[model samples]
Target: MALSRQNQSFRIPCQQCPLREITHLRDFTADELEFVSRFKKGELVVEAGSTILVEGAHSAHLFTMLSGWAFRYKTLEDGRRQILNYLMPGDLVGLQGSIMGEMQHSVEALSPVILCVFERERLLTLYNLHPSLAFDITWIAAQEERILDEHLLSIGRRNALERAAYLIAFIFERGRRLELFDERRFIPLTQQHIADTLGLSIVHTNKTLKKLSSKGLLRWQERGCEILDPEGLLEVAGWTGLGEGKRPFV
Candidate 1:
């Protein structure tokens, strides 16, 4: 359960952001930081299983993930869902909402999340005035597109075992980018999450995961899965992952 929820008007200096201290994230200039600091609205504590951004809704704010996990997904008319991508701590959410005036995909918190909110209207100001910050925004969106491309390839072409392996390795690498890597850390995901993500039935997902486990690639427990050999998973998947970049976190 969520411990508590707080909503307010607050300012967080960009230079002082927690994510900035951890990853090879881009550092903001004084002017840029000031602009972003003023842009910040407040922090939101979102509970796990709560929807953060709803599809087709007009959202006035964009959020930067301060902590915890979320996933972007879309559901069809018959309620068939496709998990698009996992959102890590440093990931930005609601870019589509900010740009298009309505959300195309929904975001749900997988773990209790802390988000840094910023007004959507000021985005054009940053783009028009701060060239570097504008590039960073473009980079962030490009990265998200790249992830979706990978998912499309996996779901469309990869076999069941390879698809499962690819998803684990891909999410783990992303977690590493967020500086959330720890050998002993358990990925807070259930088999059903994997099933939905890979477009597999729950039983098929379990069988695929067991195959990965028996091969010493991962250990899947009741509550979470632990990555044992990422390289092994990469080999199994026959898919190489994305290269790291200096990304912006705000």
Candidate 2:
């Protein structure tokens, strides 16, 4: 797990960030942009399989996902793991650690990742001086809660096949919105990731995925999953969709 930290001279400027061009994210004001530029300390790059944040550790910095994929997970003493959720470009990381003083779950890079790093100590300064940005942070937290609520509903009530369908549809929709998928419609995930996320065994996860594939919904690849029929997967999962529109990010 190689980690690289770039000095501020190499950091991407906030005003010129590519993520800001995404239609789903709100545009920042001149003042807000200037503040964010200063707030961002530098950039951190980590390879796939790198642990960016560890459970029970205190980090002096927060991060905004600049590129690539990551996941939040928690593990038991016996080493059983549960994946809480996936992270994409524009997702904020380490907020829980900043506020709570320690991370409750670990974050790992699913793909080589670039992150915009910010000083955690300056969080309160932002809240005090910039009310709207503070509100955006609160909204981000609320959004995470809503996502977890849906995940709980799926794992607690949905059948194995339905759960698998829901997870695939969820990741596909997010990637589509973020323009992460190419012509191949690939998503970076494995059966083990799906099993951990859905709280199922590896064998059961494989069987459930095969059932979805038989229905012409998705295709499992060597190192990832290809979204073949997103609408069909959503229908099978009984999910309405992400319902996202011009979301905020700090």
Candidate 3:
């Protein structure tokens, strides 16, 4: 069946669905969901290779992914682009501007995406009215901060192989937590995006990617970057899944 759009709340009946499983909405009550039920949403699932929201567009709506992946990126004046983060299902993208008023980065669909959008006005009201909702938003912001810290470390500290390995392991663990891991396949992130995320040139990124593939640690085939031996690379990167300074999620 198609997703329900009757009210601000949307219901996808397939509870065991991978994306649904990752969603953190279980803690929210039905009454607490009223504000979202009235939201104006996109009719079609935004396809991969499309812009979800442009940078500095007076972003008056906050988004929650009902399904699929997206990424946040920004371009510098010299035309150097950097992917700030890869956002999966259940991740909140626009909450950073709840107080600031506009997004600093552009958000684009990384895969076919279904989004639940709540207007800025309504979200502000809901945040003020429901402490739980506000707390959830706060937690999402903290998670973004954690990711930024790691991305900085990947660029500053790790070599190309280690940088790539850290990113692979990071996404792998996240996918595992949501039970979204596909042992036969890895996430379909683009080489260019990975290069930007790791702050490496595409040429260098390709060489490092080929090295990893040749080592049987991963396979960056036409389909996507598949992990052949996650353990091997994990040991090389020394990723503990803990934060740089403190325990993760502290």
Candidate 4:
């Protein structure tokens, strides 16, 4: 996924999708758009396992998720990786570094991912030229913080089955928001990744998944997961979107 001159024109398909309509680009002036368009058409946006920003590194650029998923992670001394957070379309990676020059966590693509990036100098110029851009960036940061809090609650208190159910429900709603998914379609994460995130063993994760299927929650397919009973799944997950004790599906 290294960006070379040969495949320069390859852009991520999700960049121009209809789902982007919900994302406001009011801060992008004609000049800003023109500058961004040059990088937009290049393959620099999508990369597999590419480190967008490393922990404790001088942060020079900010990334916007256009397609695929990414994680903010830190490796423990014993070599175990703690999954700090998961990101989706419209989410900004390492915005906290915009003011401070260093990143606290490393950001890597969870899959082949597409991102929109702006260098720190360029972003500062844009902010000075357009106060609206600064406002938008602040708003997006707040939303990201709220999401992290919700994930903390889910991973900390919920049981294995409930965690699985909560994750499924959250993914469904997120996909729907981005116009990238349907209830009949399956999610693409493997059981191993889910196990790691949910703090369960692979065997337990598989058993829990099978139990959900037997209970008529959904059908798990090779490519993704489908919700057979969206209502039932919601109940099992104990979802209360946008509340103080919310289940993190909003």
Candidate 5:
């Protein structure tokens, strides 16, 4: 028997999952993998521009991003929406909602996305039966925290140029780590998205991006921006890059 969502069948085996093959990811033990296999409820395929989670809503399922890009955002009372962060493969969603009472932010898919679903009520089983999995959960949360901190720093303190550089470099490096970065790959983000993330006006964002493009640091494609000189972006951002690490993808 199989469960379904959104006119698609949900099926992915943990044993032969492709994410396990990512070089930076730690290999899961057989038992841990087995547990995770059973822990998964199904998969959900979300179309671009679809809202996957809503702010202040009760979430019934948690998700691990199998593929594609999404962003977490919060809308103020006056209707200004601030993009909190962009989410990518192997990132967890609804983690806070699974623990807390209601979701504090909304997630909107930027591209067609595949997400592995888990029963939110059973999340405690992973924590109680598998200490290592619980630790991985903690690690993921801390990683997200660091990203949020950096984003806040960029928006609150960094100048427009530095902010733009940091954002492009940051997205490039994360995509590069996932082996998904290339000239041919569409970034699935628009200038509007960048403006929202940086808290800049659309015109200001375009001007800043043009400066990077003129300097040969990046190029704007039809629907995406290309990282031509990642090193140059890094230099402008004053960022060293994400340090060496082993990440757990399950």
Candidate 6:
């Protein structure tokens, strides 16, 4: 759970942020950009498997993912975990903690990650002075709710194979939009991760994955999952798509 905070000198200026170039995110106005530059505290580098935010704790800072991947999850008293959602570059972290005063779920890094830190206390300034940015934050929250709604439907109603296909397809589409997949088209996830997310046993998850692989929908690798035919997966899951349009992030 230990995080490595970089020296303030290492902070990436908001104007030079690589995420701003992403076509899926809205462009920031000059004033907004300047305010964000001043608002950023520094950078934090966390290794894979590190817990970035612990449930029930009040965090002093918020973060924006600059690189790598992470997931939000909650565990029961007996340690059964349910993954809520996955996060990628430009995704905001700890907003709930900032607004609600405590984190309801924990966040863990799936790979080495870089996060832009922002002081929680300064959030009011942004809301008061920049209504547009505040709306963007609201949009981001609504977007998370929308994704959760889809996951709830999958877990509550979809069959085992359908749920697996839906989850994989969901991740693939989001990553594709962010240009995260490389030539390998690999998704950095283990069977256990999939099982937890889908509310299935590890054995059942493995079998379901095998079924998908046999149908040329995806392949399971030692390191992760490889997407072969996203379109076929969508058809199997009976999902339309993530819906059209660029998404906003803070």
lDDT (Cα) of model 6: 0.92
Report the lDDT tens digits of candidate 5 across residue range 1-250. Answer: 0122442254777787777878877878988999999998778888888889989999888899988899999998998889999998889999989999789999998888888888898888899999999999999999999999998988888899999999988888888888776565446689999998999999999999999999988779766877778899999998898877888765
Order candidates by lDDT, high to low. Answer: 2, 6, 5, 1, 3, 4
Per-candidate Cα lDDT values, in order, are 0.85, 0.92, 0.69, 0.66, 0.86, 0.92
lDDT of each residue in 1-250, candidate 1, tens digit only: 1343657755455667887677567778889888888888888889989889889999788899988998999999999888888998878899998988899999999988988888898898888988888888888898788878888999999999999999998888778777786768578899989999999999999999999999999989876799988889999999777576777766
Selected candidate, larger lDDT, 1 vs 2: 2
Give the poorly placed runs of model 6, Cα more than 4 Å off. none
Residues 1-250, model 6: lDDT tens digits: 5765565787678889998898877879889888988899999999888999999999999999999999999999999999999999989999999999999999999999999999999999999999998999999999899899999999999999999999999999999888898877899999999999999999999999999999998889985899999999999999988876877766
Estimate TM-scores for all models: 0.93, 0.98, 0.83, 0.77, 0.95, 0.98
Candidate 1 contains a number of clashing pairs equal to: 0
What would you estimate as the lDDT of candidate 5?
0.86
> Among all windows of ten consecutive residues in candidate 6, which has the lowest summed lDDT?
1-10
Those runs of model 3 whose alpha carbons end farther than 4 Å from true positions after fitting are 1-20, 23-26, 33-44, 242-250
Name the Cα RMSD for model 2.
Answer: 1.1
User: How much is the lDDT of residue 206 in candidate 2?
Assistant: 93
Residues 61-115 of candidate 3: C-alpha lDDT, one tens digit per residue:
6767766777889998898988888877667767666567776788888777777
Off by over 4 Å in 2: none
Query: Which residue pairs come into collision in candidate 6?
Result: none
Candidate 3 has a TM-score of: 0.83
Q: Model 1: runs farther than 4 Å from truth?
A: 1-6, 9-12
